[model samples]
Target chain A: MSRVQAIELVYLFCAVCFIVALKGLSSPRSARLGNIIGAVGMTVAVGATFATPGLHRIGLIVVALVIGTAVGVPAARAVKMTAVPQMVAAFNGVGGGAAALVSLAEFDRGHASFGTAAAVLFSTLVGAVSFTGSAITFAKLQELMTGRPIVLPRQREINAALAVTALALVVWGLSDRSVTAAVLLALVAGVLGVLFVLPVGGADVPVVISLLNSFTGLAVAATGAALRTTLLIVAGTLVGASGTLLTRMMSQAMGRPLSSTLFGALTATASAAAAGPDDGADRSVRTGTVDDVAVLLAYAHRVVVVPGYGLAVAQAQHTIRELADLLESRGVEVVYGIHPVAGRMPGHMNVLLAEANVPYEQLREMDDVNPQFPLTDVVLVVGANDVVNPAARDSPGSPIYGMPILNVDEAKAVVFLKRSMRPGFAGIDNALLYDPKTTMLFGDAKDTLTSLVSAVKTA
Target chain B: MTETTLGLFTIFVLSVFVGFEVISKVSSVLHTPLMSGANAIHGVILIGSIVILGTGHGAVQGVLGFVAVVLATVNAVGGFVVTDRMLEMFKGRARK
Candidate 1:
């Protein structure tokens, strides 16, 4: 067999492995296996390339591998779970950047088809944008920068100009004097990337990251096309396709179009919380003991549990599930209310719950559960803040103005599990705390839920 | 330069780079926001692909451009859609 063909075969295996890895990642239980499968495939592909003809400079490659491992493994191992999304974004961006760089190198070495060069140019521009943008995104997510939406003065106009400039540079590159034009295009694209992300609110990072991951994959595919590498093409396409699908699912959960959010959403006018807690209408915030909450649940005919980031932080999913089971045994109906943007990423709550063996069917989206709130004898909110806050509906000037929220307040009795009365990710106080029907059971979520579960049994 | 070898070399080089990024978490902090922010790059891909389609290229090129446009659109629209939904969270309280 020709050496190139053999190498191709190895790449095909790697591509297959990437597909498997992606499939594994679809479910949390198999995500680790998926990662391993992808790694093994990549190893095989690399090994096969070593056997290719004219690859005599193997020493540099070996050194590169050694150095990469020395740096990568320890760094990945040391990252905290909260930083997982940031790590993924950076890695994805680098993948895109590397692909772009490789294609650029290939273009510079020789051969010129406007088509191929254009492809490479597009890839490089996007890849660089991804690299820098992801870096900034990581910073914001890590709280290195304020997680608030940073709106530069005249951001829209500046971004529009950058976009136009990038486009002009690309066209100029395609027509003549490609190198300088390409470099200019790259810079413009980089600036555009920064502007595009800077104005976005921090709450959207998960969806944004997933979307960018897809961008990186597509850039890699473009680079693959530039080089005519079948494996890179296939691997890139798989990632691109899967990432797009996931992003779509995430968008639908929020009941809005992605475009609306992209162009400086009107959310600030609509969904913000109640202004100043001293409005005095519902001044008396309800407070309760774990035992009181357990008693209320024990006697309730129906209970809906809403889990949020606090639940993830407290690692209370297992206990919450146990509490659900205990309620179910007494013939009380139970379900989980999952907000679209709960926790750090899309489906973050789902992932945690699934890990705790919570039944998938028990979880309901905001729209589905909102209607049922009035009939619910009890709505037990565990670590949820802004999504359920009534301020979105009542407070006109609040940051989260006009956004739809779960009707947790509609329930006959509402129980909140919280550490304190801190506002949610948006940093606004919720009026739900002071509702007449509401009761706050303050403590660590896991410990609180466990005690609530035990208290329910005796009640 | 009909250097097919160069293309092959690029693949290996890129693979190494990909492996490096995946293994190293030095830039872990940049992942999510970067991912979100970088998504606009897909629009560039979309625009480029559309431009190619409109330029009356070869049949093969046109077909390829069309596919790229489709894929790029999916990424662009899908990315924005998901991001918008997530952004909704900041507007209101996070419901449980």
Candidate 2:
């Protein structure tokens, strides 16, 4: 048995494990097993790589591994579920930076066949872009920067020019075999990456994060091509394809096009400012007390609870669960309506609710729950805004007019629990708040829900 | 294209189809975990980084390789662990 053959066999085994892992992830029942399988596959791949003949610098490798584990494990374990999206963004960024560094090192080793040069350039460009882009996304999600789209004068033209220059640099480097040009290419691409994500609004951050995840995958695949490793190629391409699909699905759930999400600054900012009460002072809104909302929930025959990013921010999932249980105890039906793009990421609301031991069966997707709103007695919207906005359907002038939203407006009565009269992340006021039958219960979500739970118990 | 490049391309193409097929079946409720899991899979680039670190020649290459190894390792480790933590919560929900 030759050493090279042994390594190939190990790679083949690792690849199969990854495939099975992904297959298991398609269902909730098998997701845990899928994770375990993937971890095992990664361990095997790393072990096999360690055994490659002539591999030296073992001590440094071990040191790096130790340091990484020390930082990575704790960061992963300690992160609150509310920050999972940002954590994912940060991790994805590091992966991309690592891919670019690998290519840089490879290029320094003097292996510059035209084909390899192209591969290295592609890897460096995409990797650098993904790294900077994901970092910006992480900052945005963490609220270190304003989540509003930050549009500069002539942003599109600048981005186009930067992209063109980066490409030109790549070509020049490839022809001249100059490492300096390659490094410059990476630097310019990094700038392009930052520019690409800076103008995306908070509401669109999830989709952008998913798209950047795909970018990291493509970068890794390019690294694989440069290294001539089939396993990396297979794994990277799988992630690339899946991440792209996920991004598409998220945008579709919002009923927005990808191009618009990447470039909707003009409309987004304008609509945000226009949708506020200051601009629409003529619009009338009705406010209610927590006691009133509790009575409404207690008397309802069937209630649908809509959760959103504000719900996560308030950490109100457990309190909301208690309130729902109290309602269910009084012979009221309670079901949760989950928007696909709710919270800060896709399926974010589900993770939060699941943490509170909410029944999986009671959590309904937007498509399934939208039709049931008419039959619903009270639609309790907890800390959500845009997803329930009627403007998505009724107001053509609204920026989110074409986006899909929860049909809470179709219910018999709607009760919104909000912090204030502020618009949602889209910076657009929700017409549903001013509907004749709507009642606004204003306060911090957890505090409001806590009061509601007790009120339901005593009522 | 050379035979090696062609082989890589073939793998890339086939993997795309497989990824789409496998991921399309995932329910919307698990999309977060799906994204996180896929994030970890791309951490396979750690192998490339480690290879560079082990075989790198000069001090500059060594430093670059070392940083790459560290970053890629964190990506792979953190991604898998966090995903597993998330999936564990889902599993708990399913059992009840």
What is candidate 2's CA lDDT for residue B15? Answer: 91
DockQ of 2: 0.53
Misplaced by over 4 Å in model 1 are: A254-256, A265-459, B1-96
The lDDT of model 2 is: 0.85
**TM-score against truth, every candidate:** 0.54, 0.70
* TM-score of only chain B in every candidate structure: 0.57, 0.91
Docking class of 2: medium
Encode model 2's per-residue lDDT on A1-459: one tens digit a residue.
Answer: 999789989998988888888877766667879978988999999999998788899899989988988999999999998899889999999999998899888888885888889988998999999999999999999999988677777777888899899989998989988889889988998998899899887767888888988889998988888888888888888888888998887665455678888876644555662353344422446566565576567766789999999899999999999988888877788999999988889999999999999999899999999999999989999889999998888899999998999999999999888999999999997878877578878889999899888876654
Q: What is the lDDT of residue A353 in candidate 1?
A: 93
Each prediction's whole-model lDDT (CA): 0.63, 0.85
Worst 10 residues of 2 chain A by lDDT: A273-282
RMSD in Å for model 2: 13.1
What are the RMSDs of all candidates, in order?
Answer: 16.2, 13.1
- Colliding residue pairs in candidate 2: none
